[model samples]
Target: MSEPHPASVPLLEVAGLRVSAGSRMLVKDFALTLARGERVGLIGESGSGKSVTAAALTGLLPEELQICGTVRLDGVHYNLVGASDRQMSRIRGQRTGMVFQEPLSALNPLMRVGRQVAEALTQHGTLSGHAAAARSVELLASVQLPDPAEAARAYPHQLSGGQRQRVMLAMALANDPDLLICDEPTTALDVSVQHQMLQLISDGVARRGSGLLFITHDLAVAASICDRILVMRDGVLVEQGATADVFTRPQHDYTRGLLAASDLDATDSSGRLFTVSSAAGYVPAAARKRVPAAEPAVPDVPNSTVSESARPDDGAHSDIRDAEPLIRVSGLNRTYRRGRSSLFRAPSEVHALRDVSFEVAAGQRFGIVGESGSGKSTLLRILAGLDQPTSGSVQVAGNEVAGSRENELLELRRQLQIVFQDPMGSLNPRMRVRDLIAEPLLLPGEPVAARHHAGRVAEMLNAVGLPPDAAERFPHQFSGGQRQRIAIARALICEPRILVADEPVSALDVSVRAQVLNLLADLVDKYRLTLVFVSHDLGVVKHLCDTVAVMHQGRIVESGPTGQVYAAPEHEYTQRLVASSLSLQPGSSLPT
Candidate 1:
């Protein structure tokens, strides 16, 4: 028979791919065909087997995982099922490159990032030693990393999230593989950095005529990069078609739900957000009923715990601008010593916050928006009394936070609580959800009776839209969204007047993110709590916050009503941020 036509041979092909962990199947009947220079996206929520499918394709799955599949890469055998380590290793970098979701976890903390890139090149003898080292710097530079030479010498922990991700990209592209697999590589990135990353990935693949397998939970991101899109749900492909076709004319209910969730502008008349569920389908707001909160065990903060009727939209607080400020920061400055660069040099100081000042009125929904390294976290720490400012005034509910001693913070602790970004990291894995939610009540100088713990935990679980049985389960037993609910329940257990959420929904899938955002909105309204929400997502901040403060380079660059600021951002940085944000609305496109 004559040799197959060059155009007919696909760059990557998969048939009947399935992944199982014991009796449970993680991925089912996955199939794909990608031609050279083509881009395809696998879109799904968490636990939907997007990553599992990727792992199976890359031969990176654990040995314990049962995979029955065929993955064919160009120049490779027709069937790569059960490929051995030696066989897989030969093509891992030279033929296929995989960029993982979390670069921090994927990268070696002890190794310098540049050295890691060099190692990728040194493997398979493409380049070694000095040549590889120089090529590594070139790769880093190609990814548009600022000061690539300096970045090369730094460890993964030393770099920002965006920088670390760029480093991962540098490594993934070091060998110009025939196929590139990026697994939610931009999930944790800020919109601006995420835009750059997507462009870089596109450019990299375009330059080498490489086929791309991009996996993500974000429809906007998938739209920005992929030519074709495959919607995965519950370990199976529900729909597959051209990117525009699938997005605009979704045939499956799950696909429609994903689209509905992605359209952040869409909301019910009551301003309730929408979320998708495998069980209940998708609609206005979460399906679960809001559970009433238990009465405060201690003297609650004045005007802190308002009834549902007192919600801001109900016209109960029309004069919110004239209300007494719940939080005030004036001339805030936080500096940390970096020790001496060299023994004889004067000590270096990193200015984490510079003259940062803002006020949150009682029951006000305040937002702080900034990219990484913009001092948002530093400001949050000072507000929470976790760190002292070098020079500033931080008053929460008329109590001093900056420079306050631990013993002097009991009242403040009861008045304010924080919900961190990564619930898994913030929560104790070994503790039952009951204990975790009730732990706040056991704070120093404030103790609730053991008899009340069960009642309170159950109430909190219901308040956060979780099942009552969730209180007895461990954090590991819950999904990412569920774990975040647990974190939120724990933060609200003490009925704190102020809730400071730091990037709480940044890591969630679109559907889950909508659920969390809506929950936070409803909780803030119901409890009349002062919310200081920090996020890099401009769209989210605009949707949820009344007032927003734009931060950049350790200072508050702009502060005004969210609508005004978003409509016409004055600061250049703020303008860039607004332009860089991705939207799934009609006519939305990736920023140039």
Candidate 2:
């Protein structure tokens, strides 16, 4: 038999692929070709068929949907429009491996991490149990998971988000398949971890000489790693070309809009602002430049910004005298104890936070900006009363948190609420929308009848841009964006004075993210609530926040108004962060 014609035949070929759900066509006439060892990226906003195309490629589409297309891999033709389940299963893991967006759910909770990987390897006939176990360790090491031997014994919940993602990567690479598909693998990760994950994928594909299909909505991320990019909009393939050409000269208006709305800096133009404590020998130049300068004064902006008389003079600081602070923390610290190897050895302590102090005034949208492992979440948890600080005090609505008795603490908790990053995990699967929204009101010492609460829930649903009947659906019945609206309604049910949103919309689609953000801004204004917004995305923070606080290694290095900090950063770390934010300015690549 003739050797497989590598040049004449594509590794994976998708032509005129189309999919629809009921009356709506989610993916329309999508086409692409990938040669062996080539990496291609697919980018689009929510409901643009990016994920649908990915699902079709791996034969994971739901039975309710209709598909029509030609999909071939390694010169073997397969009609995905009506392919059998057995045929698809034979091709899925053996020939094409996929790493899903959520690693936590993708990996089995009951199985050990190592066994999960080994199972894939053994099922593919790549190795026996013993050999596969050893290969699993190697795979884990290849992804740079620390102590692969020990981590193999750990479960999915035991590892951090980044680590679990690495385990997912290991499973995808276990069989050494010719094609690897990664769907927004870094969406939940921090910037540093995201960079590392991309680098790992790039290196692994090169070594195995495999074709890669990367799906994401983040333009900067796709631009950084992909050789070619395909832009999709509303179920249609708008454009496809080299990454540089597509980014430099986008042909479609939707493509241009996506690039513009991404808010990621194309280059590292600004100087460093604050030192990153986790990174060695990383001193920010901006910190050195402020040697002789005096401390700057805060700017004055009215609480409402509605009344001309209430507005301050040009140089006056913003006022919070009459209004109570929504969230307050003084000298807060959190320490985690690492287990000791021997009985005689004392457990090692990890200082997640140290001397963190700040206040978010009522109706003030405050920001906590930081890199990974900088204790941003730790501080948010303390303020939300999810976790107690190792030292220092927390006050919410003038009620002392640390010193309060159990009864008093419960009341204080009612006045404060948090919206976490992962909407899917945050919501309960068994509960319907109405019960989830009414949960906060059902807390101790609250007055909310089923009849009266149903109306309030519906009102909250509408406020978050959801339909009134959305209250009747279950959590999984809605899309990611709609589910987030349910989460928001749950947070607002108690009419809390303070809202701690920890990376709330970061996982959302760009278009959906904007809607959620606008809703948050409006809600904050109408309720006169204090907002502690924690996010790694600097662009979002700049738009949503009135005041900003930069955190590094559990400490606040800089704090001031958003405009002042963005325009002229005082700390080196802050400068780096601002610069790292992707920009669409002419003649610029991704910021270093």
Candidate 3:
């Protein structure tokens, strides 16, 4: 009924943590232990109740949701699970600090970043103006912000995603709480930044002698940060063991499947990616871990410039040299002015993309890989007709992008589609799934009939492996992976010649990522659609893209087949990128 207490009380303890709605249970019988200065990882997929468990520990769960548990932070002697709002307000950041996944949303946009962090300190303790300000700068510096003084003056919007996350970490550690809970903190970050962020968190916690409860869907990240791991599925703890044992010798089927899905080497002996079989509510068996059941028919990276019809099995390495390019760019450049300047000083310009040149062939899976601010999104936006470059010759679907008429631009848009990084931002929550998917089907003068759109929406839902009933529900009702599928379906309804995905799977659960990747590949092959994928994930890019282009400091540093570039990177930046890829596997370490 109760956990075995250590001689010196554990830093945090949970017993019979249960979160439930009127009838549905989100989390059940969840229990965990964390000692001071110890790091633990709670690993699960979306809807596995990992987040809910964290929320319960912090007493942040909604009022409507019923919570029953005993959450105790040693020496505090208060029940965190049943704590009132008044009690939780004092306890939350003071005794148990937390870092959420999205830093921008967590931070107030109008407030200066320094004030926001200082406010966290002022809440639990007393520190006046200059002292708090100085402390804020010190905290930012501790998290490795480039210029702590300048960063303290900047707002949340001014900082990069990675920097914002670092600020969040700083804010969480402001009070030096005994327990630190980080929920998917590095999910949206680039691998290089993610590694640094993890290090920052670890070092910060270690210095404070704080216990850590890291919740994440990424097994490798969990492995890298945590000493112990708890595997959860559908709200129940399937297994609990040391990190090394759980990662390598997982006994639970779900844990094994998760590992298999997260495997960078998720391939058959012949080198073809496995095609996941998805049924209605499909759960992969343990046997499916190593065996490649299906050789996904994909266009292999060509050895030489030739034609479109060549395959890897054919042993003839030919590329689409003679074929008409779907999207072409030459000497592309995009510059932005960040802040206003006085008459005495000139305004600074941020050159996002400089002299970037690349050609995407028809039906080719072209991947653009880079770190943040490396012009990956800028290049993708230019390709999608969303943004313009000052100096470049860009032709989309054989139409000049720079000098296109309104109707001509609309035509180009119809020929090309884009799926943004956050699907929730793109999809309207008020609309039904059918309406969201059918929004693209409506034309300027000719509105598609509701009945016709409904039929099409149902078909698209099925195509993405969602149930037909999902069409009736709202976007909020669906899980993240399902919402992404809906976003993909919406992008496809227009039947664009090209599909542009910007870090599509970066925010998804590892197991769900594989399914979505499989679905994307299937759709690309089925419709013979050219894919322009932009991401920091080299492994994901190499898995899906036939060719890859590496971007660094607003320039094309490397361009070649994914295999070749990964194997032998010519540029210094690219070599660093390849070397800095943070993985659970051996031979990789976070940047110091």
Candidate 4:
């Protein structure tokens, strides 16, 4: 037996690897290699074999899936595919470490944060007892966590999303593994937090002299982290090259479509935006019927209840300087008292919103941008009537929102509807699609029959580009983007005067994100509904909103027209947000 030369063998390598589930191939002829201290990114849309490839490498795939070909990822030259359970167990924490997409699901619920990290180091025949505990605290501190001692004692749920992600990073590098696989780690984070986390990952990998396999749908993020890139589509490698060349001059149509769909900084002034058709394809789908460029901007949809009559005099695309305001918030304040329920602790009030004010005119697209715990959610909750303000004057459509009676509240609910960020969380798993969308119309005092509900539901399905037969399926059966469309359909069932969207497209993939955004823009134009959107991505805000307000801490730090505020940010926090967000422009360097 001859050992491979250390100078020639790469730290990570996959040759002709293929993964399949029954007769369906998930990944075919996948080949990748990473030298020491190299960062390689695998980019693709959902169901494009990125996660499956990662699973195959890490031995995380379920038993039903069949894996073939060669995979050489080792800390001590051990085989990965057919290793014994005990041998595989030893390889996981000691040889290669993995950071999963969702920290809450990955981290143990009943364990302390420090114990989780310590177990990785101790169970793998390394540090133990006080030594492990000390190293765990050191790892947390190295990740720039505040008050490392307190964080070590806190449970997984006690930490914020960014904090939990940092903990995962600390654990991944615990034993100083030779290779690391991070799967969509920052997919759910705000721009500020996402930039910081990416920096932390890069720093950690560099400190350990480890190779990284970064998998994500974000192209700009890939450019920032990975030196090399692989583009996958429909279980095959469409293109592979250096990050710069691939991004600036992609050869494959699939790669081009992904790039066009993910360009958030794109706008009308930046040239005609590259748009992917409704049908799924790298190139334009053969069945797609595009409208002439000269026609009105609004898309034509058959069997849609939304029409010219549904729209107000002011359209979404028109300049709304002369339009009347629909929502007004003046000096709003919301305070929450902590430790009030405990007899031994003195109650301390936390100001969630302080003197916040903004206005949304009829048919105006208004965006509220902020990071987590920046009071954006608090302001949105108050507007949705889910929370009461401590002191403020809030008015919607000439109706006072503060201290309304039950009947008045019901009326307000009908006039204003809200769509949440997580589509699956907002939908009912047990209910059929038709019944779920019809729930709003079935409210008391409405004279609607079963036949009418079915008709209205079918019409909305057609409008959202879903099939009529989809009504028979449950929410769990649909994809994440489809569930979001269903959520949007439910919000529009009653034809509400105002639509409040809270990060509606953040959870979707690049292509699905474009589709959903186009749908929202069309709905706003056709129905003339005022939109109040909350997001952390400034590029998204600039594209969809005419005006934007930057929220920091508990106050409105900056507010102006979208282009003005974005182009010349005055506040420090606002400027940082714009700088940290990924760019759509070519040759753009990622945040460090």
TM-score of each: 0.89, 0.73, 0.84, 0.89
List model 3 lDDT by residue over 33-75, tens digit each: 8887888999888888998888888888888999997888776
| Model 1: per-residue Cα lDDT at residue 140 | 95
Ranking by lDDT: 1, 4, 3, 2
Candidate 2 lDDT score at position 434: 91
Which portions of model 3 show Cα errors greater than 4 Å? Answer: 1-9, 83-95, 108-111, 119-123, 126-132, 268-317, 321-324, 337-348, 427-443, 446-461, 467-477, 493-495, 586-592
Better of 2 and 4 by lDDT: 4
Each prediction's whole-model lDDT (CA): 0.83, 0.76, 0.80, 0.80
Q: How displaced is residue 94 in candidate 4, in Å?
A: 2.2
Lowest lDDT 10-mer window, candidate 1? 303-312
Candidate 3 or 2, higher lDDT: 3
Q: Estimate the TM-score for candidate 1.
A: 0.89
lDDT for model 1, please. 0.83
C-alpha lDDT (0 to 100) for residue 329 of candidate 2: 83
Model 4 scores a C-alpha lDDT of 0.80
